[model samples]
Target: MSGETVITRFAPSPTGRLHLGHAASAIRAHDYARERGGRFVLRIEDIDGTRSRPEFVAGILEDLAWLGLRWDLLVFQSERLAKYQAALETLKARGLVYPCFCTRAEIAASASAPQGDAAPVYPGICRDLTVEEVTARAHLAHCWRLDMAKAVAITGALAWHDAIAGAVVADPLAQGDVVLARKDAPASYHLAVTLDDAAQGVTDVVRGVDLFAATDVHRVLQALLGLPVPSYHHHPLVVDAAGRRLAKRDGALSLAEMREGGEDGATLAARVRGGDRLATSW
Candidate 1:
């Protein structure tokens, strides 16, 4: 919309091989940048260190290369812990983020209703903890969750523009107090992505529609951190013949498997763009 040099990125977590769904998203981002003579970036979202394997990271790079996808810049989130920590501290100083020690079971038990497709909305269990109480739990394992209500009050009304969906208002409340830093990881996806997008100077974010809702939380983070908000374009997700969304755990046909079964990289990319359903066997 701004006619500025667009910067798009294909960020994938290296926990498994690239599947057809991943290919579609990558191709969309790459083409968006290429169409405008802009820069395309590749970011490895390996923040989940325990599950993020080096072999998977290597496989991701190889898969993208095989697909003829080129990136102007490459970054790994594992290497940017300090930056994320700094951003978290900035929020903490603003009294916008609080610690939450709730486990999965505890949260599910406390939630009043189902929270849109994902885990139930966090019910702000620890949002009003006293300083002494917070100090007492400092040594225990905990996560930093954004104080959604406080955040909204500070930022007031907010909105962002999307290419397909048009202008959208920010609704951080629906997401509840999203975790900024997890007990197991230095930063959560919402926090890392918002910071990384700003750090990379990305002008346009192109990805699947599944993440369209998550944009609300990201917008709040951008406003709280005083970071530039980028235009978003959430495309449709690739689904199997059964209409089930593709996922790594569902034994979806991976790019590596397709290549081994004699699929050409460029041809496969074209088929993906054309919305040709992939065979489960191949």
Candidate 2:
């Protein structure tokens, strides 16, 4: 890699308290930035207004501080709607995105295979909507979905560098049409994250391995939008003793709960850095 200063970010949705999994991810991102004398950013993914809460956002800040992980800059997705809108309009103008009106049940019924780890691959029911049909459905609440085929056609043969996997070809077709914007939220995670990473000059994306597959979609978006693709480092997830992935539902493992129980922040941070054998359960 070049000797340029690396920039990484720990972006978490403020829907729940910071759990052990979140702590581990943050520690990894922060350490990566610090090791290279670079910058670490904290991004609040609060696009889902219905689920996101101010209290949760406050808890996230307090937890990150207690964990001894400092960020060089902080950004909130809720504050960047206009940027996402402009990107969406650009895609629409290029005929790379269309409105999707399918509900959860409708999509589930349309899916051909058993739902995999990620959200069921969106069947392209709305991809072929005619201008008049789209005009009629324009009044109804709908989500803007990227036409993966057209996008791939526009930017043929894409790839991204990964620290673990090396150069990997991006296969966004597996994801089908992904929602870029929703009726309730101005931007979906795919659109918001790709744009934010570019805007913040994130050179390295360090996150859970679960998101490795999603990188394909993001890479395609980067190519379509003319944004730079960052190198990725997909780390293993923190799991409980039973090997189950840590989740927000495990309230006892939340950083706030640990702090309230008189746990040392540095000790917890060290444990997370050391590996999966945490002193506390997960």
Candidate 3:
């Protein structure tokens, strides 16, 4: 993307309050673009209707603003369900995806092997169902799964670049037929994020290293949909006092709490930008 404006984004789910880890990530993404005279976008990954809250959304906006971070554009994945559904339909129409009627229990029970820390690799149990068979189970809840073998065959060998890891080969099959969408949740993260980055004209993706492997699946999705491939920079995740990654589910202290406790948002952001202390002193 030489000569192209560096476009980066910090897409976070509004399930909980932002923590220092989030601050570091947001600073990374924000600084990456601002340093390059580019633009930074703030995207809310709130497709999980069961967990997303408007209050959290408001809190995220407030926290970032308090950090002196300004976004050129704002995006919400919840608003683009139709676009994700259309893309999933495109894959289904092309025979690149199929309806999976298997429940979570059945999938876990049938997993041939685990793919690292990811959920059990789907065994494609419903991959061979006939059109009539699918129609027969019309009442059954189902999700869309990419036909990994077919998809990879159609796309051939694919690859992507990471600013930290450098050249990497695409390996979506390693993850099996990942869910693209479900009846209850029309847009899956893999599908929505891949589509959103391309649609938003993101040139340089900046995020935590936890999603490094997920990039492999995203690469295949990008190739299948013929989306422009953007450069990636997967930075190390922020750690807490325990030297373990902080998570909202783990009840990590939030930026809101820190700000209320008299911590300076801009000072913390500046420390993050300077790579000061993510482990003990933060």
Better of 1 and 3 by TM-score: 1
lDDT of 3 at 108: 84
| Highest-scoring model, lDDT | 1
The per-residue C-alpha lDDT of model 3 at residue 235 equals 94
**Candidate closer to the true structure by lDDT (higher is better), 2 or 3:** 2
* CA lDDT scores, all candidates in order: 0.90, 0.89, 0.88
**10 residues in a row with least lDDT, candidate 1:** 273-282
lDDT of 1 at 9: 97
* Model 2 steric clash pairs: none
**Segments of candidate 3 deviating more than 4 angstroms:** 113-117, 278-282
How would you order the candidates by lDDT, starting with the best?
1, 2, 3
Kindly list the per-residue Cα lDDT of model 3 for residues 4-40, writing each as its tens digit. Answer: 9999999999998999888888888998999999999
Clashing residue pairs, backbone N/CA/C < 3 A, model 1 = none
Query: Candidate 1, residues 83-144: lDDT per residue as tens digits?
Result: 99999999999888999988999999887877665799888888899989999988989999
Task: Name the runs in model 1 displaced over 4 angstroms.
Answer: 1-3, 114-117, 278-282
Model 2 C-alpha lDDT versus the unseen true structure: 0.89
Worst 10 residues of 3 by lDDT: 273-282
